[model samples]
Target: MTFTPTLSLYVARGFLLTTLLMLCALTGLVALFDFIELLRRAASRPSVGFDIPATIAALRLPFVAMQILPFAILLGGITAFWRLTRSSELIVARAAGVSAWGFLTGPGLVALLLGAIAVTGVSPLSSAMLARAERMDQSFLRTGGGMSSLAGGRLWLRQADRELDENGVAIVAGRPTAARPADPRDGFARFELKDVTVWRLSAGDSPLARIEAPRAQLTPGTWVLEEAVSFGADRMPTRPQRIELPTELTPGRIEDSFASPETLGFWSLPGFIEVLEQAGFSAVRHRIQFHSLLATPILALAMALLAAGFSMRHNRRGGVAQMIAGGVAAGFALFVVDRISAEFGEAGSLPVILAAWVPTVAGLLLALSLLLHLEDG
Candidate 1:
C-alpha cells in the first residue's frame, strides 16, 4: 500500500518463489505419471529397456514445466495474495495509503517475465526433448526397437507397388528439397526431392538397378525423374533425359508422412515456415505454433491478474471456499479455451493470430475489468 520499492520487491520475490515451488511439484507429478504409463506399455514388449522409461521421464520434465507455467503463476499469485490478506499485511498496507494496484504491479510484472523465460529460454529445449522422447516412446510401443522417427531434411520412403512389374520395386531416399501441401481444391500436394537415390530390387531381394537423379517428383502415376542416370547389373550406366518410374505414393500420403510441427523448436520456426511456404505448403501449423509461443508471456500475465482479482478482496465480505473454487475454475477455463483455440488455429478453421491470442486477450480484458471495478468500488 505504501508503494515503496522494498515492499514491491518483497511481493515479487514471494510470488516468484511460490511459483517455482509449484512448478517443481507439478513437474515431478507429471514425470511420475508418464513413467507409470511407459512402464505399463513396456510390460508387453520384451525389447524395451528399464532405462528407456527413466530417460524419457527425465527428458520430458522440461516440457511439463513449460506446460504448467500459467497454472503455477495463477496458484502462486493466489497463495501469496491470500497469505498477505489473512496475515493483515495487505490491510495494514492499504491503511497506510498504498493502493491495490501498487502491490499487484510487482507480481504482474514478474508473471510476464516468467512467461518470457518460458517462451524464449525453456520452449526450444522442451520442444526438442519432447520430440525425441515421443519418437523413442513411439518406437518402443510400435516396433519394440530401432528408431522410427520421421521429421527433418532427410527422408526415406518405400514405394508401394500394387501391379506386378518385371522391372522390380523401388526404394526412395532423398533430401526434401520442397513440398506443396494438398490444395484439395487443386488435388495436388506436390513435392520436389533433391539428391534423389532410387534402388529397384529384384524378386530375390537383390539390387537390380541403381538410379540417381538431381531432382524427382512423384506425380499421379509416375515418378518424374529429372537428369536421371541408370546403372543396371549387366550393362553400362546410361543417362536418360527424363524417366518416368511407376509409383503409387500420393501427395496426401507424403504430406501425412512429414514430421509434426511440435518436434521443431521455437527459434527455428520462422525459417521453417519460410521454407515450407517457399515449397508451396500452407505452413499454417508452424505459424500457429510460433504465434502461440509469442503469446505465452501475455497469457501468464493475464493469469496472474485474474488470480489477484479473485484473491485480493477483503475476506470478511465473501465465502472463502467459494472464492478459492471460483479462482481455480477460472484458471482452468482459460487453459481449456487456449487449447481449443490452438486446435482451431492449427486446423485453419480460424485465422492464425486470432486463434493463438483470442483467449489470452479475452482473459486480460476480463482481469482488467475486474481490477478497475475493485479499484473504483
Candidate 2:
C-alpha cells in the first residue's frame, strides 16, 4: 500500500528532527573540544582577543556537521526504526500491506534532500570560513605577530629576465620568509633558501633559462642570489653573471601560492581544477574532492540502508545487539576504505571517480544483499 502525502510528510519530519538533533549535539561537543584546544594554544601567544578563536570554532561547525552527518543518519534511522519495531508500529504498517521499501522511502528521500543541501550550500560556507580561520590563526597565534622572517613552504614568483629575453619568469623557493609585505611589490622581504630553482620559460613557449641558487633575498622587485649558477637552453651553466634579474615580481606575489586541495570548496573545485590545469599544476586532489562531493547523496543512502538492514529485524530474533555491532563495524570499514581510496587517488594510482564512488557502491550492495536476505529469504 502507498502512503498518503500526509503520512509521508510526517515520517520525513520525524526523521529529520531526530537526525538534526543528533547531529547538533555531536557537532557541538566536537566543536567545544576543538575550541578549548585553540584557546589553550592562543594563551601562549600575544594578547589576541577571542575573535580568531571564535571564528575558527564557528567556521569548523559545518565541517564537523558534514563529518558526523552520515553517522547521525545511521544512528537516527536505526533508532527510529527500532522504536517503530519495538512499539509494533512497523508491524502494524507491514500488516496493512506496506512493504519495507515503501516504508523506507520517506526517510531515504529526506536523507537525499539533506545531502544535497549539505554539499551545495553548506560546503562552500564551511570552506570559506576554514580558509579565513587558518589565515587568522597563522597570522596571529602561530606567527605570534604578523609575518615572520623564515617560513617553511613552497613559494612561487614571476620575474622578468632581460638578459635571457624572458619577460616573465617563475622562481620556486624551497623555504621562504613567512613575512607579510605591506605592498605586494616591496622586495625588502628576506628569506633563506636551502635550494632555489628558477625556471625561465620563453615568452610564449618552453624553458629558456634555469637557475639554481643556494640562497636568495628579495630587494624591492629584484632577487639577489648568493652562490647562484645559471643554465641555458643547452643545459650548460654560463659564466656566473652577477646580474640583476629585473622584474615586477614581489614578495606578496611569491607568498600567494596555493597548493593544498582542502582550501578549495566543493562548489569551486571544478573551476579551480580548470584553472590549475591551465596554470600547469596537477588537479588530482581537487578531482577526488569534487567526485566525493557529488557522491555524498549515495553515501547517505548507503548509510541509511546499512543501518536499516541491520537494525530493523523483528525483536523476537534477539539480534538487536548484534545488529548494532554489525552496523558500526560496517560504517567504520567503509570509512577506512574511503580513506585508502582517497590516498590512492591522490597518488594517481586510482581514478578519482572510482575512488570516490567505490565505497558508496560497496556499501549499497552489501546493505541491499543483507536486506533482501532478511526480508525475502
TM-score: which candidate is best? 2
Task: Point out where model 1 deviates above 4 Å.
Answer: 144-257
Q: Which candidate has the top score in lDDT?
A: 1
lDDT of 1 by residue, 188-255 (tens): 77777888988877555677778899989877768899999988887578967698887656654454
Q: For each predicted model, how many residue pairs clash, with residues at least 3 apart or on different chains?
A: 1, 1
Candidate 1 achieves a global lDDT of 0.79
Question: All candidates' TM-scores?
Answer: 0.73, 0.76
**Tens-digit per-residue lDDT, 237-305, candidate 2:** 867655445545444333322434555678678876765554455678888888888999888888887
Q: Quote the lDDT for 187 in model 1.
A: 78
Q: What clash pairs does model 1 have?
A: 1-98
lDDT of 1 at 359: 88
